[model samples]
Target: MLASKSIKMSKEQVSTFPNADELLDRMRKMSEDESLWKKSKTDSGVDIFEGKVSTKYRQFRGVGYVDQPLATMVSVVKDAEKRKQWNEQMMGNEVVEDISEHVKVIHSKFNGGAASNRDFCVFYTDHLSDTEYIDAQTSIIHEKCPVMKGFVRATCLISGTRMIAESPTRTKVFYLGQVDLGGMVPSFVANIVNMKQPLCIARMRDFAMKDAASSSSVPSSASTSPQEEKQNEEK
Candidate 1:
């Protein structure tokens, strides 16, 4: 029915196919696609038989569109709670097997990358906990996240974000800072994360896309290496 689907799409929409499969296959896939919105519409045709089912159906969420902000918020909260449990186990001096249950809670199989960024965070923590854990985590962002390397000044509100205003612009990234120590003691690590809005994302785009070396944003030195900056823009 969708014979004209070959119409050209811009680079962005090109990745997000509105209709990925025929009606029946979509119905079958719905059980596996949690975010899919499956619906049926009446099929009015002159040649339909009485036993026929509704022929027009749709399922979609588009690619590269994981509700980034929503996913960021959800991931932060979910990971934080799980991490809290891990800390508790750590405080109790629990070992590897004990902390693993907490790790599984945060693993995301959604887009299927060799374990996503969040998974990496969980895996690293699995090996490093208690004493070594602190250094491993703080070093992770520096080693893995370019943003943290050049942090000028940052604050973590119970909001699960670090509001950073670099010279060029301000940004509030959800997974950016260390947890505030005030909430739960004796290994209590509660990092807050707020819901992501369109504005929140737009505000950070300047920093993300900026020529980091030139931008005077944030007082600290820049950490984005020449090689990695090139990689980021390709994404």
Candidate 2:
């Protein structure tokens, strides 16, 4: 199981991910640059784009919409453990630190099929406000985190996500990620990452919606556990 430790820090003491604001800006700019993105293979409403970031590496970006509340979408992103449940490529995942409710560090490994298996330790933070747009970013940061001996360490150089409420029950999401695979990767393996973005958003929406339905369907009288019921009877 993933373990977490939290420490309170003053606003000035909190270290922001380096250049996160710039990363978010780049993400927004890329999201609107539809001239670069190509339609994804999936029919799930996500658009995907890929371009060379450097001579040796390429980056991917994706945009999509989900018919779920902003809070539900944010919950999906913050629940790192739940990712392994839906993302087939995620072989192992754990949270190393909970800086606070809005910040965390996670270590995850992925199976790239024929490509080299890769792992990364990333620092993620969420910036949410009622009037300001919801935004988050994940960046490669050095920490005293454990590493899997066998997997190659991939650098999640910088990734940003932005979510905007479209209505009371809908949101627009944009994701940008730049990863260094550490070695040559097959075209097919890369394609899978590019195409999986939309599907991920869709899956999150489905899970959140179903959980909301299940919760709403349960009777309030039966919401308590057996232990709580026994304690109430004793009272």
Candidate 3:
């Protein structure tokens, strides 16, 4: 089972990790720069793009529309406890340290089936607004969570989701992920896995839609007006 540990850190301690603002800026630029991305493929109405990054592994981006309110989608992604509900391979997930409302250090373990299990410790941060929400994360070293036995430590070069409200009941989602599953895995297998990373968007959409439908307290439509959605789309 996954659990969270609360650890209070001063501003100085938080500054030791990579700057969240800088990561957000880089993600925004990469997502917008058409020159950096090439058409990889499209699945289930989502367009996937492949691009080069600093690592040997390629980065992937998926753009699509989800039939759920922006807030519902955001909650689905941000809630660590509910990760296993949508993530098919997730074995465990926990917050190792809470840096702030927008930032935290997380440890996640995955089941690799016949192969050895994999895990990662990442620094996560998110920004939310009425029209758009951006959450970005990169792998980081944390003392509390070290490379554990029986599991390979994977590296998340960069991964996040960018969401824009399109209407009262729809959202435009952009998911970007670049990860190196460090091990003796064959390149062909790795490539195949990387190509399917974008499918996570669809899985998230399905899960969020179901959750929203089941919850009576949650509204089916967002409060954002059509004019507001249009203005956000323009920006």
Candidate with best lDDT: 3
* Tens-digit per-residue lDDT, 30-91, candidate 2: 66677655543444566666653333334566667877778777777666665555566888
Model 1: runs farther than 4 Å from truth?
1-121, 124-192, 197-200, 212-235
- Extract clashing residue pairs from model 1: 160-192, 160-193, 166-217, 166-218, 167-217, 167-218
Clashing pairs in 3: none
Give the per-residue lDDT digits (tens) of candidate 1, residues 110-180: 11123211111112222222211110111111112222221111212111122222222322232212322
- Per candidate, the number of residue pairs that clash is 6, 0, 0
Query: What C-alpha lDDT does candidate 2 achieve relative to the native structure?
Result: 0.62
lDDT of 3 by residue, 135-233 (tens): 888887677888899999877878888988999799989888877777786656665777788888888888887877678676558678889989999
Best by TM-score: 3
The candidate, 1 or 2, that scores higher on lDDT is 2
Q: What are the Cα lDDT values of the candidates?
A: 0.24, 0.62, 0.81
The list of candidate 3 runs beyond 4 A from truth reads 1-15, 52-55, 215-235
Clashing pairs in 2: none
The lowest-lDDT stretch of 10 consecutive residues in candidate 1 is: 132-141
Candidate 1 vs candidate 3: the TM-score winner is 3
Order the candidates by lDDT, highest first: 3, 2, 1
